[model samples]
Every structure is written in C-alpha cells, then in structure tokens.
Target chain A: MLRPWMRCSKNWRAMWNNFKSKFLGTNFKRFMGFVKKEFYHIFRDKRSMFILFGMPIAQILLFGFAITNEIKNVNIGILDKSKDSETIHITNRISSSPYFKIKNIVSSEQQIEAIFKKGQVKAVLVFEKDFGKNLKSTNLANVQIISDATDPNTANTVTNYIQSILQDYQREINLGIPGREPIEVRSRMFYNPELKGVFNFLPGVMTVILMLVSAMMTSISIAREKEQGTMEVLLVSPLKPLQVIIGKVFPYIFLSIINAIVILLLGFVVFGMPVQGSYFLLALETVLFILCALSLGILISIISKTQQTAMMISLMGLMLPIILLSGFIFPVSSMPWPLQAISNIIPAKWYNLILKGVMIKGVGLRFLWKETLILLGMTVFFIVLSIKKYKIRLE
Target chain B: MQALRDITFEVKPGELFGLIGPDGAGKTTLFRILTTLLFADEGTASVAGMDVVGDYRDIRKAVGYMPGRFSLYQDLSVEENLDFFATIFGTTVEENYDLIKDIYIQIEPFKKRRVVALSGGMKQKLALSCALIHKPKVLFLDEPTTGVDPVSRREFWDMLKRLNSTGITVLVSTPYMDEAELCNRIALIQEGELLVVDSPENIVANHTDSLYKVAAKNTYMLIKDLKDFKGNKSVYAFGEFIHYTHSNSDFSEERLGEYLEAKGHEDIKIVKARAGIEDVFMALSEKKGTEV
Candidate 1:
C-alpha cells in the first residue's frame, strides 16, 4: 500500500543508483587520463604532427591540381597523303583543339614508326588518298589513327578526343548541304560540363586523406606503445583494454575531423569544387567513414608487434587497396570482375560512392542509405575483430 | 614454442624476491604472466593474493610493472608522464609522493625535460617513480638495471631496499650475479628452468668444494692449462682470476700453484677464496645441464 508519488520516487532512486554504478564501473576518469596522455604524445612529436596534418593537405592539393586523368596538349604526327581541301581542313581542325598539338608531319608511312619510336609523337594520323573526293562522291572517307598502346588508358582517351573533333567538323561541313540528312548523336556531359579532372578527383582525395590520417596514424601510435614496452605497463594498470584503445583512437578522431575540414576548404577555394548537398549530411557521412578507418587501425595495431610493421601494413594493406580498388583512380565497373568483387569489401569504396552521391549528386540520405549501411557494417566488423584479436594476444 | 614449463615459485608479503637469469631464460615471460599481461598455457600464477587469469582486474590494481626496456613516453616531459600514469590509476602524485619521494627528488630538477633527453640514470629514476606513483602492493621489475651504469645500479638497489622497508613486496629480475646478494631470496634460472632458489648466504654455504683463485702472466693459457689439472672439477675465468673447484675435497692451493709452475707459468699467484653467488649459480647451471 504505497502512494503513487512515493512509488515513482523509489523507482527514480533505483534508476539513479544503476546509472551511477555503470558510470563508475567503466572508470571514465581513467579513460580521460589515457586520452590526455595520447594528446601529449601527438603534440610533442614534430615529425608525427607534420605527417598527421601537413601530409593530408599536401596530398589533397597535389591530387587536385597536378595529377589528372584527362589528356591535354598531346603531340601527334600527321601523314596527310591526300593533301585535299577536306584533309587540310580536318588537320587544321584537329590542331585547333587544345587536346592535341601536331608535332611532326611525315612524308611516308615508314617515317611514322621512326617518329613514334623517337617518343616525340604519341599518336599518328594517316589520311587516305582522295579523302575529299570520296566524301563528295560516296559520302564516306577512310582515315587511320594509330596511338601508342603501351599506356592503354591514355591511348584510348586520345583516340576518342580525335574522333569527337572529326565528328564536329563533319557536322559543320554538312550543315548547308541539301538532300543529305546526317544522323548526329547529341551527347552532353552532366554535373561536370567541362569534364574537369579535378572535379572527379576531389571526392577521392577526401576519402584517401581521411583514411590515411585516421587508420594509419592510429595504428602507428598504438604499435609504438607496444614497441616501447609501455603497452605492458598499461595492461598491468587497472584500465581495461577497451578503454586504452578508445583513448588512443579519440585523438585521431579529432585530428581526422580537422583534416576533413581542411581538405573540403582547399577543394572549394582552390579548385572551385562544389559541395552541392547539405553540409551536415556530408559531415555525418565523413565521420562515419573516419570511424571505419579508426577501427581498421585498431585491428592493424592488434595484429602488429612493432610500429614499423603496423605502418607497413597500414600502407601496403590498406592504402594501396583504397587507391586502386576503391574507384579512386579507376572506375570500378571497368575493372576486372574479380577486382570488382574485391572492391566491395574495401570500406573506401562505399565511402567514395557516398561522397560522390552526397557532394556531387546533392543526394540526401534516401539515396545514400545503402552506402551508409555498408560503412556502418564495416565499422562494426572491424571493431569487433579488433577486440577479439586484442583478447587473443593478451591470452 | 613453450616459453616456460614446470615453473613454480612463491614470494611472501613484504619480501624482496629476485629472478636471476640471462636474456633467454624466460624471465620476461614469467614477469609478464605475473603482471597479468600474458597467460600461461599449463599452469597458474597469482599476484597480491589474486588469480592472474580470473581475478586479473583486482590484481592489476594491486601491482606495478616496469619492463626491461625504458618504456616511458619519450616525447612527453617527465612530469607529464608521471602525471598521466598517476591519474590513470585513480590517484595523484601528491597522494603517493611519500612512496616515490627519494627517486622523484633526484629527477625533479629536470622534470620539464623530455624523457628522451634524460640520461640513462635519470630515465631509470623516472620509470621507477611512475611505477610507484600508484602505490601498488607488489612491484614487478624485469631487469630494471640491465643497461644502467654501475653507480646507478647500486643506487637503484638501495631504492628497492628502501621501498621494501615500507612493507611493499618487490619482485625483480636481473642477469648480474652480484645483484643476487641484495635480494632476500633468489631463484637461479636458465633455459626456462629454475636450477636453484635460496638465500645468497645459504647458497654459498651449500657449496662443498674448496674454491681457489689462480692467476698467471698468461691468463688465457693458464685457463687452458688448468682445465687439464687432474684435481679440477670446474674451471671458469672470474675477471683477473680463474675460479677453480677441485674434485678432491683435500686439494690445496699450494698444490695448484705447483701444478701451474710445472706448466711453464711465471709469477703465479694462488689463493683460497670464498664461494660467491656467481660460483653457486655456475655450479647449479652445470649440474642442471648434466641432469637434462
């Protein structure tokens, strides 16, 4: 027989006691101490600080400005055997485009191989004889384009640019002619109208910088403690292993956030890379990716016995895959089937997809839920595996 | 690989115990287990009356460990490192200042300097202070004086004696035989096996053979010559002198001196000497090797 108010007060008291015990059980004060020590380690070392903050900005700027996939100012050798008005007009049109510069003109086919071998010209274009006559009489003409196939990507892109320039010239010539209706395929580039390489590379740089700073830095820091023998001392203390790991990871999380902001600002200010979506959503997704990378770092630290090993594994095991297989430099659809399947497991792949979706496509969570879910799953998997591996090493 | 096997020893409360062994004698492995950093596959260990496996959390709060290497944060200042460790242990430097006052005061002048800039002796003192800041019940130090200078080594032992006087149990491991005399009890281990465990005096008293120190002009050749002596049971070089124990209990130093003279050795000096812990350690290791 208790009053209702009294019953509610008793329940509240019990709840408060449970909450207090749980808070005391984890020893938050000790965890804060570990986190503070980690900050001291980060701030005291000049070299590590440079690697943490400077490297990210440098990498982002380098990728945005210097490194590119687009072909421009390529040197080509033209062997115009026809010497007709149409052939001359087409040659002039090709040279006018900024994508190519006619470096050499050969008199014979034999000179084509010699010029290509000299490395002065990457492509050779030979016009068939009577090119203008054939176009007027049979409404067709033959032209050959031979490019260095050693670098297949560059070769393909160069050939495509030349074909598009020739097609445009054909439309201009046939515009006033009557009784010949040529079918023209109108193609337009969306989102990036000029096909600026920086636009495509911005999201990739963001993913790589975040992944490297978060995963690689955290792993190296933890492995350093083990190498110096301080990890043993930490284990002997009353701090739980989970607390130690969280404390080590917390500082990197803050650093990685700052790095993300720096990269976004540089991309916007220097390259004019647009952030079409909500900044808040982009930030939330970036944080999710950073957590995934941090957990991956923890897993690497647990398996490594020394800082050098941890660094090597983080670079070779994680960075290379993120660069090659995460669709950062190459399109995933064009990759080999096996590589495509393997890319699915790389967390950066999902993060890159989400970045493009949110930042470039201006899509909300509804469009990016799948990628977000994948990143969340990877974070959970890495954290769980790290904990299990840590326990096994302790035993 | 099985790093340890059939290892068994005990340390009483308020007693200073020593694990005397060389580099690969599994001393570090044993210390790791006792500190709850590692698990033994086939046996059990406990620290501060708590099981190392089941009650590791309780044991962790009651023990402090300093590994063989200098393990403090090299980038952080000495004071920062000390403060971090103390704070993590739910205590402060002021709370445990009395426990580490002697060692801490030595390095207080350079407290603002980074640990990497400190001399070996100062680093040792800083590590000791950090380990003691928590006021742990049992302190496990694995070869803390291995790379330290001799002067620092002696000072470290004095510090340990003072800490032990406060009723805190200390377990320390070292490879130096001379350090064995400082411990109340020592376990001589080799190749992951404990050959003998006893007080230094008792271990020396248990030696049955009459030991002699023999030195000549050519010490190396003298050792080669002494190995062939018919009365020799064990012969080893000890600094400037070769410590020789005879199979025959009645063997005399004069007889050994005469034998060396017969071997074309000049300026020979032979004297009866007392057995030391080093001698006992060598004899026990040899006996254990034969038994194996």
Candidate 2:
C-alpha cells in the first residue's frame, strides 16, 4: 500500500545515514588512535617527560630566587675621616637602610682601596675631613663614592642606592631649618609598589617556558620522523598531511596547557605573584600563544630536513629572538629603532603584552583583544606557510 | 639531482615483485613514488588502479609501505607500536590478527620492550608486522633486509611468501642479487634506469656470453693473468674463483689452460659455469655503460 515516492525517499535516507556514520566514525577513530599513539610516545620517554613537567618549575624557582635585578644588602666600605657626631649619624643612617650593609669603617683612603681590591665590598664611600663644617658653613658636603666598574650594572645600582640614602639623611638633618628642605620627589611605583623583580620577570618567564616547550618540542618531534624515515610511512597512510600534523601536535597542546598551569601555580605559591585578572582570560591567552608557538614549530620543521637542524633553528631563531626582543629582559622601548620594528613581528612580544595585561593589569578582553588578534593572525599565517611549504616539499 | 628517470614497469596483482639493484640505484625513489609519498615529475604512476597523484587517498588506504629504514616509534613498546598502526588504519588488531600473527608471535614475548632495545632482526619483524596490520591489497618493502643477518633474512622472506599466498601483492627492493631468485618477477635497475624486467629464471637464461670459472695457486694473480689474456672480455673474483667471460663466442678451455700455464699458474682448475642473476646484472650494467 506504500507509494513509490515514499520507498525512494526511505532508501535515500538510509544511504545518507550510512555515509555519515562511515565517514565520521572512521575519521574520529583514526584521529583518536593517532592521539593515543602520540601520548604513548611522550609518556614512555622519561627524559622528554621530565623536560615537559619539571623544567617549568625549576626555571620559575631559579628565576624567582637567584636571578634578580634589584639590589639588596650590598656591602659598602665607609671611610669616615672625621669622627664627629654628624659623621657618626650619617654612617648610622647609611648602615640602617636595608640597601647597604657597611662591611668596614675605614680610617684611611688606602684602606678603602684595599677593601675594594679584596672584593669584599662593591663600593667605597669617603667623607671629607670637615664634612659637618662644610655642610654648616657652605650648605654643601662633599662625599666621594668610588665603585668597582667591573660589573657596571651592579656598581651603578649601588651608587644610586647610597645617593638616595644620603639625600634622605640630609632631609632629616634639615627638618628643623627654615627654607632648607630639598624638593622631595615622592614617586610612587604603580602596579608593583614593592619593586619586586619577580613581578616583572614572571610574565616573561611564562612566555619563554611556553615558547620553548611547545615550539621546540613539536619541531624536533616532527623532524625526528623525517630523520628516522617514519614520515614516509605516515605519509603513505590514510592520514592526510594536515591530519598527521594535527595528530603530532595534539598531545603537545595538552602538555603545554599543563605546563602553563604549573608555571602559574609556581609563580603564585613560590614567588607570591598575583593573578589579578580572570583565570579564564589568562588561560585563553595562554592557549593562543601556545598555538602560535606550535605553528611556528611546524614551519621550522617543514623547512628543516633533520632533527638537529630543527632543534638548532628553534633555539637560535626562535628562542634568541623571544629572549632578546620580546621585552622579556630588555625594555622594548629602549631597543634600537630597527630592532623595535623587528620585535613587532615577533609573536612572543605580543603574547608577553597580553600576559602582562591580563595578569598584572587585571584587564579583560576589551583591553587584550588587539594582542589576542595579532597572536591569532600569526598562528594562521605560520600554519598556512607551513602547509604550503610541506606541500611543495612533498611534491 | 634526479633520483629516477625513464622508469617503466608493471606488477600484476598477487605477484611477488622484486627490484634488484645496487646502492644508489634509485630503488627507494621508485618505491616512494609508488606509495604516493612523492610525485613523478614527468611520468604517470598508478597503484591499485588509481593515479598516484590524484587518487592518493584511495591509494594510501590500499597500500602498506615499510620504508628503507626502521621507522617505528622507538620509545613505544612492541605491542603499542602494533596497536597504534592497527588503530590508525581504522581496524583493530584482532580484526586483522591473522595477517600479522605469524610475524608478531616471534616478537610477542618482548612485546613490552621498547623498539629501541630490540635487535636488528626483531626491529624489522616488528616493522613488517606494523605494515601488514591493515591487510592492504599491496605491500611495499624497501630494503627490509639491508642490515639483517642471513638467517633472519631467510625467515623474513618466508614470512613474505606466506603473506603473498593470501593474495597480497608484494613489491620488495633489495641490493642483494641472490634475493632476486625468490621473486616471481624482478626489475634490475642501475643509475635510475630500468635495465631489465623479467622472471629470475628467464633473465638468467638470457645471459649471452659463455662464462668460465678459473682458479689457481693465487686467485688474485689468476685474475691479473686472466685480464691480460687476449680473449678476456671481463674478469672478476667471485668467492673462491675468478669468473671470466670471453670476447669470442666460441670459448675454448684448452686455450685458457695453456694461457694460465704460460703465466706460471700451478694447480689450475677450469670449468664451465652457469650465469646467475649477479652475472646478468653485471653484463647488463656494463652494456649500458658502454652504450652511454
């Protein structure tokens, strides 16, 4: 009793359903298989696993505790030629500040040279014979600060700290005098009021660790297949080139996410660094950066024929630029014009900006949309280039 | 540099085909093209009745390739490697267990061991098992026994023969001429060109010259003396004797004996020898060189 059209439509629906299941079911299974295999490869190699999980924590601790730019407790030799009450008071004031630790009270200039030569003190502060008399008679006291210029950065910082301490002491002495209070520049440091170097470096460290782990790991892995001749087998399989790339990179994405989390936790617990913004926004930015880095890795792998070449390229080409130009250590505003322009193209620079904006500035998507878009664009560009290069090379 | 040039041959379904060549003979290049890993710049290639370039997806599903090197994940265990390949092919190990069971059983006890720890033969066996996991209609093995021992090489060939019995066409390439005899059909290649394509027996039968094996007190000196002999076309040492071919069609044993005697060779033995695939290969190579 059924019409002919009804039977035809029923057959058509059955064919469509069969095709959908066959296509999607097989692809999903194959992709899952690839991802599982990748995980096995990662987990079985203890060395790589250690690098993946342990390195971020170690680096965070190392950067937080050992490597610092702030000066604290610098040993300084004081040459007090006058044993007057004023000189004693100045000496006490200098020693009382946390920035300077007076190692010796030298009686002569020769003693100052000897202490500096022994490398016990970084700088020598010499007060003149009539220090109080000069300040009372002429409203000027001459104090000589001779610092060892061997390490210019430390020497400069030590000298600046002593000068600030002396200025503070002078203000205290002039508190009772009329019209003699120096112009006090009460500069309040914003964002990081404590001036902790850890606050400045943690974001840079996050950027660098994510870049190294995600980019270097992926590039070396893909190039290793080429070196071992396994890429040929994979290419000959039913997996497309893009699928092969995604399969290889899928596990790394998860690892990088874990790495980012570990870095954030270490920064919070060990360094007491703040995450002022929403954790969701921070995570989204981190994933964006990781994708950008991974795409760059794919591009490098497509160009390199061997694992060694890939590794070298990643280190020298990617790591160096990220460290030097991404405002990680050196301020981008201070770099030369050409280098600054070049840094604009470096993906890490934008990522570091986004990280700082979200983590330190507590900004939302409205403030970070530009940097996020740039990173996303770079990721697309790198992926397209890599796919084009891969096709050309394979052909 | 051009790795392959003017290469032309055909392999029938279910035939055990071999590509016999020396090092740098472009055997790997040909296999790469046939497996859809590379494209031919000038000519066309098809596998399983599909164009290599256009129908690569279908070809990939229809073919299984074992590259010239051990290409498995060295960090993964034997079981993991096998399971990975099976899963990627959209099939389970149990579904095609019969195809690879013969080879996989040999390495089953060490299934937990990483591939890097496996011996050379075990590695090749594992690689072969991975390739056959999908039960494709065609299998391409490039230099599977290059570094394998003699005993393992024999066993690997036996495995291939057993697989071929189940109607899977196999294309194997090797530098060893002796392996050519095991193939139903072989193509001898040199310097990226096809030298000959035929059954091993037919190629050996087609050897043109009358060959001789001569040995004396010092085989090295015998080779020198035979090279200086007037009728010598080619003289090379083969294991315990020197295999020599003559310029003239009518080769006389008495002439060679007297020639060796004149050169003060003692304990001289001379006999007619049958040409093998090696001899045919050498002759064809020399012919191509002279023509070029």
Please report the TM-score between candidate 2 and the true structure: 0.91
Candidate 2 clash pair list: none
Model 2: share of native contacts present? Answer: 0.80
Question: For all the candidates, what are their Cα RMSDs to the real structure?
Answer: 5.3, 5.3
Q: TM-score of model 1 relative to the true fold?
A: 0.85
User: Lowest summed-lDDT stretch of 10 residues in model 2 chain B?
Assistant: B230-239
Interface RMSD (Å), each candidate?
Answer: 2.3, 2.0
Tens digits of per-residue lDDT, candidate 1, A92-196, equal 988988889999999999998898888988899989999899988987888999998878888999999998888887788778888665888988998787788
What lDDT is obtained when candidate 2 is compared to the true structure?
Answer: 0.89
**Could you tell me the lDDT of residue A68 within candidate 1?**
74
Off by over 4 Å in 2: A1-23, A128-146, A173-178, A392-395, B247-250
